[model samples]
Target: MAIAKGYAATDASKPLTPFTFERREPNADDVVIDIKFAGICHSDIHTVRNEWKNAVYPIVPGHEIAGIVSAVGSAVTRFKAGDRVGVGCFVDSCVGCAARDLDREQYMPGLVGTYNDFEADGKTRTQGGYSDSIVVKEGYVMSIPDNLPLDASAPLLCAGITLYSPLRHWNAGPGKKVAIVGMGGLGHMGVKLGAAMGADITVLSQSLSKKEDGLKLGAKEYYATSDEETFKKLAGTFDLIICTVSAEIDWNAYLGLLKVDGAFVVVGIPENAIPVHAFSLVPGRKSISGSMIGSIKETQEMLDFCGKHNIVSEIETINIQQVNEAYERVLKSDVRYRFVIDIASLAA
Candidate 1:
């Protein structure tokens, strides 16, 4: 085992602090990584603060990871020392399950999260990228394109793939009118990817504060949702609407904006239950659906696509010590986009 340094949430009410833990030695199929950067995801804040109600104490909360390969086990065939790589939400799942066979391992019955969860062994706890190092299975690791910087690309593991999956699933392309609800971390990526895919992108945000940023990021149109006239004007306009905000909103009002047979996809988790009327769906054959992160195959596809288009998150970098402050900023929507932690600061 190798001793690792990181930050952990020892309890729900307290802030994260420096922590030391052990990483298992490389196995025949494992890859050892020296973590270079970790992106601060809103989900990380939720898990650390126990907002999700399933957090385990002393949890190291991070899944958007970017790093370099330091060592590879004898059986690791695809990666070698000094390779740029990344790891996402899950580290393992049932090896021979149907979901794995279908390349949807994220939904497998025995899926293991990268942190705040137990590994497949049932006894070993799985820590995450908030640390200085990690040992992961070669099958679960992804290669980062050389053109993409490790820091800006870190959030691609989670935020990038999360939006990419739904867009691809819905066949977003030329002639499609897409509305992205929110202009924060996930919303910004959706705008970039959706526009790159040839879709006519629109941003429906709480206010017009980020309208300029949204348009600069590829949105063709930006509207303030807080304005009643905006809703009235755009009613039954979009072919697809992807809601990326976690805050409570009127689901039915958004549903009314969809065209006949259009779909409303949710990628964010709101605290309270969303009440949707049957009339919202019954009228035009419009549908409401939800998407989680994508499979490893799809994630790699997203990375390759990003490489081709020179796409990455709009990020603000911070050192590990300032993570707590960053979390507060994230809650208040103070970040221009995403927050990425420079793990090298841990050694200071």
Candidate 2:
């Protein structure tokens, strides 16, 4: 066993504190990673705080991980001791399942989250990457492109892939008019990526606060949803709308912005039940859908795609000690975009 140190949520309400734990020694299919940067995902907050109604005590919560490979087991062939790598939302899925075979393992019944989940053994808990080191299965590890810096690229493991998967699946390339709701972490990536894919990207934010940043990030149009006229002007305009905020807004209003046969995809998790009327979709033949983080193959593709486009999340780097404060900042929407932890602080 290898001793590991990280911040842990001991209870639902208490702050995270330094915790020591054991990481299993590398097996033949395992790769030991020196986790350098861990991105603070909103999902991490949800899990740690028991907002998701499934909290395990002493949980070390983080999934958007970027690091360097320090060692590899004998059976691992794709990674070496010095490779730059990442681990995303999930770590494992049932082998030989149809979803796994199709490289859509995110939908597999046995999908194991990188954090706050049980291993395939069902007894051993799986810890996450708000730490100095991690041991991951070779199949679950990703090769981050050399051109992308590890710190900035960390959030791509989760946030980037989360947006990329839906964009790709919905064919948000040339000739598509796409609207991204919310100008925060997930929504900003949607604009950047949808634009890169040749879509006519627009930003539908709560207010104009992030208008400048949205345009700079490739959003051709930016409108404040707070203005009634904004929704009126854009009604029946978009071919696809991706909502990335957890705020309970008028779902029907967003649906009305889509063209006939258009789709509204939700990647964000709202706290309460979203009330959607059947008329929201029946009139326009619109469809509502949801996407989790991408499969391993898809996530690798997202990393390579970001590499080619020189795209990375807009990040504010924080040390391990500031994670609790970071969480509060996140709740207030105080971050410019994503928050990445410099894991070296854990060692200090």
TM-score of candidate 2 versus the correct structure, residues matched by position = 0.98
Which regions in candidate 2 have their CA more than 4 angstroms from the true location?
98-100
Model 1 poorest ten-residue lDDT run:
98-107
Positional deviation of residue 148's Cα in model 1 after best superposition, in angstroms = 0.4
The lDDT leader among the candidates is 1
Task: Name the lDDT value of residue 250 in candidate 1.
Answer: 88
Q: What is the lDDT of residue 29 in candidate 2?
A: 99
Tens-place lDDT per residue, model 2, 134-165, is 99999999999999999999999999999999
Candidate 2: worst-modelled 10 consecutive residues by lDDT: 96-105
Please list the C-alpha lDDT of all candidates, in the order they appear. 0.94, 0.93
